[model samples]
Target: MDIKLSNKNLGLTPSVTLSIDAKAKEMKAKGINVIGFGVGEPDFNTPDNIRLKAINAIENKNLGYTPASGLPELKEVICKKLKKDNNLDYEKENIIVSNGAKHSLYNVFQAICNPGDEVIIPTPYWVSYPELVKMADATPVYIECSEENSFKMDTEVLKESITKNTKAIILNSPSNPTGSVYTKNELEEIAEIAVENNILVVSDEIYEKLIYDNFEHVSIASLNDEIKDLTIVVNGMSKAYAMTGWRIGYTASNKSIAKVMSNIQSHSTSNPNTIAQYASIEGIQGSQQFIEEMRLSFDERRKYMVDRINNIEGLSCIVPKGAFYIMMNITEFIGKEIKGKLIMNSVDFSELLLEKANVAIVPGKAFGSDNFMRISYANSMENIKEGLTRIEAFLQEKTE
Candidate 1:
């Protein structure tokens, strides 16, 4: 007898980034030296303070479940954080803590979406956005954000995309894959549109603290009271505090939506890791010096990666203002023969580099763009240098 899987999940696409990273790790386990640039997690260890806090919790505090949504204390801390960092005032009633920002986003979609509703997503999005929308039984409307526009959704195009069926739009700043941060002006325009159209804004701000060039992060929710109520701000400790494994993520939205999300999560996963929630409280209120150090390190690597990739023939990348990934344009190499293999798209170029040079980078097709590939600078400078050197040499290689 055969077992049936959920039809929705069957149609779901597995994460290409994780798959590529796993393959690279498998090669490394087999003694192959693969320099991986896939997956966006910071390579730095969780800061000592945060780790010690977890230790302290395990030893001192009760490890029992907290509230279904999150610990009240943790929610209080998150509320304060939003006011201090984002200038958005919210009560604990409006916040829901989930396993990770990814989980928080999933909760948002599930709670707000209805069947046949449409959620607008900008192209070259984080790998999970469209998938999450589809999982909610909502249609994902794609808006192609061009490279020339720094992959940001333009207001004009956004207006054209909205319709009676539209339920929401996703805004990711210091965007994953492209590292594009929207300016305050751009967000203000978006805020106006959202308010007019009565569309919810699911703002993913997980990379807020990883921005560079002193570029300020402006939350679309902070623009006005109306927009604030219409926005669900998704963030977590994973990117900023290097707490990927801890899996603490949250969302700030209207109280009604938060209640729905909490109810949904209560049955699904229950309270997030109780120990992690306690630790996250400490991570939020503890010394933030670790964040600065990580940001500076990433900034250095980002600069080096962009400069080197630009200098190399047949490849180019725009300077990313925030986040730690570079979207290297591989269009120049398309339809050409490299190492006796025809390179037609980002996936072909990525596979060639991985097989021949042992450098693992994500093809842009994973992010909805086929003319580019994304490389993360979350690795050390040494590894980044080695990876790029290998990539450059791979581009020059010829077969007998």
Candidate 2:
């Protein structure tokens, strides 16, 4: 007899973003010339000083497991970084370091949500937010954020979505698919709504340092004491430090929530990697040079990608203020034929690009927006230019 699978694991929709990335890699393994616009991590390597610290930890025999939450030194650095950069204060006891920001969010949802609690998520949300809520046994309530509004949810939507069973709201700034960052005024209003309703706010600022055009990131927790009490700030060394492979991400919340998450982690994965924790200490406290250089490079690519996407016929894009992904609006191509393939939606469009043009991009339906496709410019300028050129040629070949 076959063993029955658990309900939670059975309910998940495998991540579409990662699926596309894997397929692109598979094609390239077979020696195909596939230009990928699906990468989410920085193309830069981890700064030398940070990597050296990790090496030092292993070389000095400091690789043993420390605490379930995190290394105290890493937590302390997180606290200092919060106060200095995000204007939020937290003690070491209030932080829990997890395998990655993704894991941190999964733990936060598990800690705060109950069987049937509701989480308000704004779409086009990061692909994982809704799934993470489901994994926590909570209901995901989506408020469709419009492109005209820069895809940022306002207070009015929040008020309408909240109910007595509402448990929390997940906020991702410098958002993944849309690349929209919330202004301080908007965050203040959102924070006020949570305060009045006695609800929790989980702010995911993983892309906090990748912002462009001088758009400063504001944490909802930093608005006031009331929201601070209700907010959990999630960040990591992945995006900012180009340490995605190191797998270190953390959460800052009230001690009660942090303690419970730590308890849960202790019984589960124990601590995050010991060497990675040591490296993160240096990542936060060590340097300003590589961060600025990488940010500048992304900004240049962001400008070029937006302009090129807009100029293409049957395609358009709003200039993303932060993050590295551009959501190309492909509404005009829907119901149209390209090389005998009917582009019914963003997925079809994405498939056509991959099959015909040897290009890879993600469908917007994965982010809950069906009329657009998300593309990453995290590759070299040569690849980005070549990828868009192929897409342009493909469109012209069919439209003409």
Per-model lDDT: 0.93, 0.92
Worst 10 residues of 2 by lDDT: 149-158
Error of 2 at 378 (Å): 1.1
lDDT of 1 at 333: 86
Which structure among the candidates has the greatest lDDT? 1
In candidate 2, the residue pairs with backbone N, CA or C atoms under 3 Å apart (3 or more residues apart, or in different chains) clash, namely none
CA-only RMSD, every prediction: 1.0, 0.9
What would the per-residue lDDT of candidate 1 be over residues 1-400, giving only the tens digit for each residue? Answer: 8999899989999999999999899999999999999999999999888888889888996699899999999999999999999998999999999999999999999999999999999989999999999999999999999999998998899999999999999999979989999999999999999999999999999999989888989999988899999999999989999999999999999999999999999999999999899889989999999999999999999888889999998889999998899999989888989878888888888888889999999999999999999999999899999999998887876532
lDDT of 2 by residue, 1-400 (tens): 9999998879899889889889989999999999988869999999999989989999999978889899998999999999999888899999999999999998999999999899999989889999999998999999999889998896787799999999999899989988999999999889889999999999999998889887899988998999999999999989999999999999999999999999989998999999999999999999778988998998999999999999999899889988889889999999999899888988899888988899999999999999999999888999999999999999999956
Model 2 stretches astray by more than 4 angstroms: none
